[model samples]
Target: MLARLLATAAVGGVVGFIVFHPREAEATGPTATVDADEAQRWLLGGNAWFVKGGRHVGDTSVERRTAVAPSQAPSCTILTCADSRVPPEHLFHAGLGDMFTVRVAGNVAEPVTTGSIEYAVEHLGTQLVVVMGHERCGAVKAALSDASLGPNLDALLALIRPGIGEIEDLDEAVRANVHAQVAGLRRSAILHHAEAEGTLTLLAAYYDLDTGVVTFLDSPPTSAVAEAAASPRTPAEGHAPTH
Candidate 1:
């Protein structure tokens, strides 16, 4: 009976050791990557916050310090004009790491701009791309006035010229510019592939500085009108038709 008791104790001790001293300790893995759909929802939520006039007064330095030590979440890519009036983060009421933004005069999409956007969508996995154009864009005005631009300014104007030709009226021109940029992005090889594969969405939007309301241009591309000021065809090209 003593021998049987010793054997049972040895077996129990062995089982206890096996349970306590696992061959491989399980450590916490990396944090999960934010999915594209979740990112989009976050972006819309930020916009809703803006619509409600929510204020974020937290210490940015503290937030930045914390995020610097680890990873952060970026939900959307906003391509907007360089107009001082349009502060992307503030307008969208987005906090740090909530948006990946690209700004250029007239919000023109050239190779460099497109490359940045491609990086955001392809590498950063941003699901929603907002092409935001604001009221009275200087670039559009310059294009309309045929103002002589400096070297860099010339290149900028060139990018916006096509869109200008599509609109006869200045107000319409502004809206058309947004539409043109959106269509340009849609036709972009990288963006088009992602859109076709249902990986990303491109939205064209105009921000009314007066009303503080952002109107999304949701009309089908076929129904939208191109600006006459930006088009190649002359006035003889027939009444400026809608897209």
Candidate 2:
């Protein structure tokens, strides 16, 4: 009798488990949609709250909902290095659609890169373009260290080499690379026209990985224009041009 009772109990438990574990088709629910503007507002508020040492006003559900929304057009375009350490969203405290970002090794502005920037400016209506670089950049380091590379890499290294050659210090070389890329972007016909017409503003910045701080090379706005203007034409040679 006891054996029969134990068998009956086991049967019941097995039946209960089977009933509770529904098939995949039966477990689905209605899809949830997100509102982009509300998400942006929440993200902006969250950043401000975090900066002020305040608690999260919203919960994970809200963030999850926000994640599903379509990203709106970005007002700013950033051309930055493809470094794992330098995540643009985290560094800028931005959420989806807040900034349009293009990442390349060494943040080199080749023709293709400039073309993308032009499309963003002309179509997406991004008013600001930032060319950013970071400390201990591996691309810049490779260009500095390696004298010989295969054709494709050598071409990339050539672009980075001019900037590396401009600065004696490795640390300064990183910043010089950022400034050089910014100059290269500015000189592009599309960007130059945009700048002259005051439709776009181009700036360069350096990211400090250790400190989590971004220093604008051309702070005060005016200084960037002046510095770019004063920068020697033959920057790689390290000689300031005489009047």
Candidate 3:
């Protein structure tokens, strides 16, 4: 897919030539060695731009496509919910090949997902992992309500149930579930070693559907305190769910 896009860029004329020659290199900058703090700050800036209706630079340009054709070294890996409204690339105003994203219904990290994250960190040199949960997520709502579901869905929700106890509000449950997923991710030895060695940082975040805002929950509370700590908060804390 990346190769095809690059081919089109190669033949696309003056604009293509400019995009191919110098612009691509300058825009994509080698992400292989980006530090966790720099990567997270970049994502936060992009999210702020998205909330302000700013256009993403060089995202779908032919030059960008061509530059990343040979290889991809995304700076961060995002584990977010499968909500259509919260596409990670779009929410963060990131370009193609800039973010390695893994999407599941509730943003839960099972063995498969954890393995993928490990690969991104160990192989691709991705520095940051953002586990993003969103407001009014259908999967979360179903799990919180204990809605009768098919066997497959029931099993998936069971993974989420351990995180949410008696949290009645949908938003609060969503937050707790994020922490729970973080806890699950911490169990990965690969991730543990990376964090210990200062090569990786795992973060929790929340997305608001209506406001197009993403809030990074810095130093998220541990799972032991996740349920107990969730409480109503003002907009600054990213607790007010517009949806």
Candidate 4:
């Protein structure tokens, strides 16, 4: 049964699962002790470098490549839209083995995506999880339309609809969508347990296409005030494609 399931996952070519029981509660890595603050700072610094066209591409040297070929230890997990323009690595100026990314249309959290995230949190030593929404998201925009969609697409639209509320503004709805994904992620037992243990931090962010700015949204207890709070915005790299 396990072999069959793994085979099916491989055929789908969407999410590939590795069945392994993690040892202990601590993240495993050379830099396993990286806390939530350091993860956030690293992302911010990467974005700064990216915006300035000084992207420090990861250690692509043959020796360095061979070193990490044995294993990966990403510091963060980013759940972002599948928009071709919003590649998480480019936005954060990351290189190979630096980040574990989960991408889906509208960046909505569904079972498959959630499962991938759980795998990262449980096995990849990732301390930070960012659910990012971008400007002019097509998925959110479609929710505002009455156009008929196929069952699969309709299901995706349904997940994004509630986030939009009654707001007609696209940008506002996009931010709301990020908050919604963050909430959905919290429903995962693995994620919730990690956060409760102070080993994880969940964040929401918005990526503006025009300015390449990524503004971190305030988290819970302050989430209600996120829209109003003046957040520190960093210039992100890359252009976002409509997903």
Candidate 5:
């Protein structure tokens, strides 16, 4: 599968060139080695507060904006759906320059998206990369059926098809796509080196529209999957099924 994944990238052309490039990126400041565990803790805590109707913890003030103007030292990079309801900053209570985010229809990890991720992990010193799949995603729904939307959207849906082969359930298919994206990203030689040296981490996540909670959907251990199941959510926090 790994070989096949790289072969797909090579045949596609862009990712093959970008993945094996010899250039390395240097962090602008210290603390660039912020580990994935620490970043995940901060994100989860912020999300819990968001669900509980607490105040936003992220600073979006002028001072904060000016500080990060020259360079950004975000702890993580998030790639999620371009769906309006799944806004990363609002969902996570993140401020300006807090995290680098890549938003597209299906959160697909193709050559261009993967290349952007490579920049963040290699040059920006980001420690964590999250590929988030949410409930009731329209892109997944369209891909599950044989609907011809248009040329651009059709191309986008085609990228998501293989990840969700033979799956009929929308929620299950969404999770499957997330795992498939993570696998494709992990095969990058640059990312492979970072993981091999214990510097970078790639993981999948799920967001519940009702609960406003983000669940880490990685290969779980120590009963985290059960412990982090859906919790009671507020009526106001629940979205109106826009996703």
Candidate 6:
């Protein structure tokens, strides 16, 4: 699965849904210890509530806020695009500090991004990592375009450009970018160690803006993922066809 995943850069138009479990409680202080499987349940169930139009946003009352004010013990770390439309908490109906999020234009796991997630995993006792990409993502659209964005935007696009190649389909592009970013996250030594030691659960997801459905991308076996992340890649790599 890692070889196949690494070999291709294009994401199919199909949406894959949720899976995986997390680390056991290892964090100290006010951080809450969350079971990865249980956390997945909350996210999946919360999404159900979201799709049903039920208000399931976890407690946000002053007391709830006060309790989590000292320190946050999020169950999962979500690395997703910074698109305003795809708020992880609202989409999953999660409440205060239920998740720790790292948002970027294309959800790229650059140095700082990886570091933030690592902090959650090592210090906060978060055992699960969910890397989500949404449909109609502006960052992806930008990456697919030939237009001249500013320096920073271009740099961001540079990171995304090689992931999906020249795929013209937006859905395909979004899917490809998500997996590529997942690979990038796995490259983090801290994250890789966590996965290798059986203390982490990594997953990919697709968010449909229209239907409000979050389809989790299929992940490879643990060993495969670890091996693939350990493998090196250059800027010229991963220009695969859309399936």
Backbone clashes, each candidate = 17, 0, 0, 0, 0, 5
Q: What TM-score should be assigned to candidate 6?
A: 0.77
Best by lDDT: 5
RMSD of each: 21.2, 21.0, 11.1, 10.0, 12.0, 13.4
Better of 1 and 2 by TM-score: 1
Q: Number of clashes in model 3?
A: 0
Q: What is the lDDT of candidate 2?
A: 0.56
Off by over 4 Å in 2: 1-71, 221-243
- Measured against the true structure, the TM-scores of the candidates, in listed sequence, are 0.69, 0.63, 0.77, 0.77, 0.78, 0.77
- Estimate, for each residue in 173-218, the C-alpha lDDT of model 1 and write its tens digit: 8778888888888877999999999888788878877754565676
> Which 10 successive residues of model 2 have the least lDDT summed?
11-20
**Candidate 4 lDDT by residue in tens digits, 1-243:** 432232122111111111111111112233344556656655665554455555454434565444445455666789999998887787665655566788899999999999888877876657789999999999999988767799989999999888778988888899999998999999999999999998889999998787665778874434322322222222232111001
lDDT of 6: 0.68
Q: If both were scored by TM-score, which would come out higher, candidate 1 or candidate 3?
A: 3
Weakest lDDT window of 10 consecutive positions for candidate 3: 11-20
For each candidate, the alpha-carbon lDDT, in order, equals: 0.58, 0.56, 0.68, 0.67, 0.69, 0.68
TM-score of 1: 0.69
Which residue runs of candidate 5 sit more than 4 Å off their true CA positions? 1-31, 221-243
Off by over 4 Å in 4: 1-31, 219-243
Query: What tens digits encode model 5's per-residue C-alpha lDDT throughout 1-243?
Result: 432232112111000100111111123332344567656655664566567766665666676556555455666789899998998877776666667788888899888888878877876677899999999999999999998999999999998999999999999999999998888888888888888898898989999999888888876623322322322212233211100
Tens digits of per-residue lDDT for model 3, 91-182:
77666566778898999999888987887787667778999999999999999875769999998899898899888899999999998998
* lDDT measured at residue 218 in model 4 versus the true structure, 0 to 100: 73
**Tens digit per residue, CA lDDT, model 2, 1-243:** 432232111110000000001001011211221222222222233233333333333222444234323222444677888899886655554433445678888899998788777766765455678888998998888787766778887898799888668566778888888888998998888889978987777878787777655556775534332333222112011110111
- lDDT of residue 52 for candidate 2: 38
lDDT of 3 at 43: 65
Which consecutive 10 residues in model 4 have the weakest lDDT in total?
Answer: 10-19
Q: Please state the error at residue 51 of candidate 3 in Å.
A: 0.5
Compute the lDDT of residue 237 as modeled in candidate 2.
18
